[model samples]
Target: MNNTTQNKPINGNSLIEIGYPENEILGIALKINKKRTGFTKAEMLDKYAQVMSSPQDFTEDKIFKSLAEAFINGIHLPKIDEEIIPLNENPKEFKIYGIEKIEDGALNQMKIAMQLPVTVAGALMPDAHQGYGLPIGGVLATKNAIIPYGVGVDIGCRMALSIYDLPASHYFEHHDILKETLMKNTKFGAGHGFHGKYKAEHHVLDDSKFETNSFINNLKDKAWSQLGSSGGGNHFVEFGLIDFKEDDKKLNIKKGSYLALLTHSGSRGFGATIAGHYTKIAKDICKLPYNAKNLAYLDLDSEAGQEYWLAMNLAGEYASACHEIIHQKITKELGAEVLAKIENHHNFAWKEIYNNEEVIVHRKGATPASKDVMGIIPGSMTAPGFLVRGNGEENSINSASHGAGRQMSRTQAIKSLSQNKINDYLNDFGITLIGSGKDEAPMAYKDIHEVMNAQQDLVDVVATFTPKMVRMADDGSKED
Candidate 1:
């Protein structure tokens, strides 16, 4: 059985990959292989090391007679290994609003998230992965205003689909040239160069109202300079089709061959500036009952809030423009026309109505799922991803999980999984990938199928694309 359960469930421990900290990580006993469930993050971290047969060494923290009771009582872990030690740790209980199921690690993250100064309501997408402030796959609804941390620094980072009319065979025809273009023409890793895809300045969108100040002036130039570039990490450009081969039957590939350029990114540094700028502003004000970390409440009538909204929308447009540039460059080489395109903005908040009342929707790693709100959910390098349309599920506040959440951390993936395995996996898929760091290996993420099923009511599947080759650019080592 897989960690992701769609039509055919696969194995979680094997096929499903993760990167948890060694010695710190807790998994079901090796002999048992599969268990119905596992322990919560707190319990695992607190007690699993002692008397536990696990990956990490156990001699770190000895659980003595004088240990805290809460840690001792919180051990409802899966019964697998040769020894079954019942614990009595009292975990900090979290109230599940809409998400009924959550993993131990995700719950721990949620515990931190709940403590964030401002919290509207959050839905833990099944594929929840740990993120900076809020967890990925986290759908948060704010009260009257919004939280920058909840929305995240990567404003409008999203996925763009470029469907080409070229056939799959044609891709192979110019494979070498394509690879060359991806290599010398594109940059990956930390310190990526734009390779001169466009002018060295980002054009300000007409729809926004931010002034032509220094920050905006600098951002505009830098954004345009990065046109057609795929920043490092999980961001990528893959060549794939929308066909599925379940059994001998094939359906809905739209005949012929199509090349899809899919990537996950944002408005670059401009968005980060906005997030940082507004975060400080909100924090400086500190008028909310919540802490500064949760600082927020953007009055539509206020200049600051309105300016941020305008800048945010402009950044979103810039991101779309970046994708368009990439799509155009890729298609120019192939000599094909774009059949259709789709995109969605994540990492930003929007004022939307639910039950006729308007509230701010802050989605960090989430996509808008408001009935026909088109978006894409990308998987790790090794998994298949989905393109979906929102169905307006009110319970979820019209949102869906972003991607397969991370099952393991970067540290763990590097230690337990090998580079050889990564090479072999890519070889089997006939895909050549570049720029994924220790954090972005395929094994580090959760099961996307499980995540999608859990939020079925939030979106309707429009199409599916299996990645072939992915190109991610490096943004240098400047903490990008």
Candidate 2:
């Protein structure tokens, strides 16, 4: 029998007949030991034979209930020398795409996350790589719970693309102006914030959610200060050419090529603080099994859970606002009007219904792909990114990989990859770099084409983007 399967309540009395709100100890014990919380009367009697025969309480009901609570909470169960059994139940096996390409470390992390009692279902994308709790391309659904580490450190990290009315050739003709716009409008790298003339303003700063929770309120000043800046690591902003050999409603563009700007970033320091604060809270309260410690969860009905939901959504808005500011400022400066845009977040959670049951779906480094929903999956700076629409496959948790998920860690790239080789590779791909580090070299990632191919059923490529000019963090700096 699947341990995660919902059990029927005893005569509609949840924790009541066995001592509900009146019995605080029993409630805590039930919460700590999830398996034996609502056992049927017959099963209860059979499982606690010693407790049922105890004479101290005289009544079977009183004696068995007390012993059950004590047994679950690791306290003395009267004079019974009984050993509590562990919940050795397996969660639903995760459906993985491109399993052969995924690393063993990432697969191990996925197994641990699946062991979490809250996990309802899980999926691993082709771009899977080891991350905090869930792998970078892992998707997880939990029952009335949310995992902070599963959402990862960079909350609301996303990709946005704005297509322009100008032809692809226009970028080269006005290269200097486009370059100047990027330089003057956006700041990149770690701790890069709006200063002097580059400071940006957005309506997200006025959101009430910021003050709804102390965590968001405390991050307001910092969030406002860095409104338009892009965080470091693989985060970037670039000019590229989007190709569509056939007309599509998703893009609403003719069968031709056009100039586009793509930006990848998150909620900056604001997100990091919220993640750090709530992750600690989750870890402190939920004492999960050893392998599942990083996968600690908070019940949706809890105060912290509600607060985190608000904070996470607010961070998404902040991230979108940052993208808007970057695109608006750069486009306006370049005198280029927006034709159309595509945007989607990869690092976030949503209240989704899967298997006809409501669950909190967390996509760490994955994109939500609800049937026909549009999203962006980027590759390395030099490789191609895809404009896709979700196929809404249930097994995949309606998601796709966020990018050409890292094939190598930052430390590995920095050590083995030389600047000259990176430059040569970029030049070979006709990618012009404005600012970047060797750590983000194209070699550091898996082939974008292969990743897209692996998840073909999850998403359909509507268009492809080839980077012409890219900007990212410079060498020898801390990652975001």
Give the Cα-based TM-score of candidate 1 against the true structure. 0.71
The global C-alpha lDDT for each of the candidates, from Candidate 1 onward, is: 0.56, 0.75
Candidate 1's C-alpha lDDT?
Answer: 0.56
Candidate 2 Cα deviation (angstroms), residue 221? 0.5
- lDDT tens digits, residues 1-480, model 2? 122432432331323322222234434434433455555432332222222111122222332455544433434222234332222376669998888779998898898888777788999999998765677899999999988878876789988999998899998898888777777777875545765565677889999998886546866877887898887678889999999979986556888899999999998767765775677577656766545655778888999888988888998999999999999888887777787888999779999999999999999999999999999999888888999999999989999998888887665787789899888888898787877776688998999888988999999888889888888867333332
Alpha-carbon TM-score of each model against the true structure: 0.71, 0.81
Q: What is the RMSD of candidate 2? A: 16.3
Clashes of 1: 32
Worst 10 residues of 1 by lDDT: 15-24
Top lDDT: which candidate number? 2
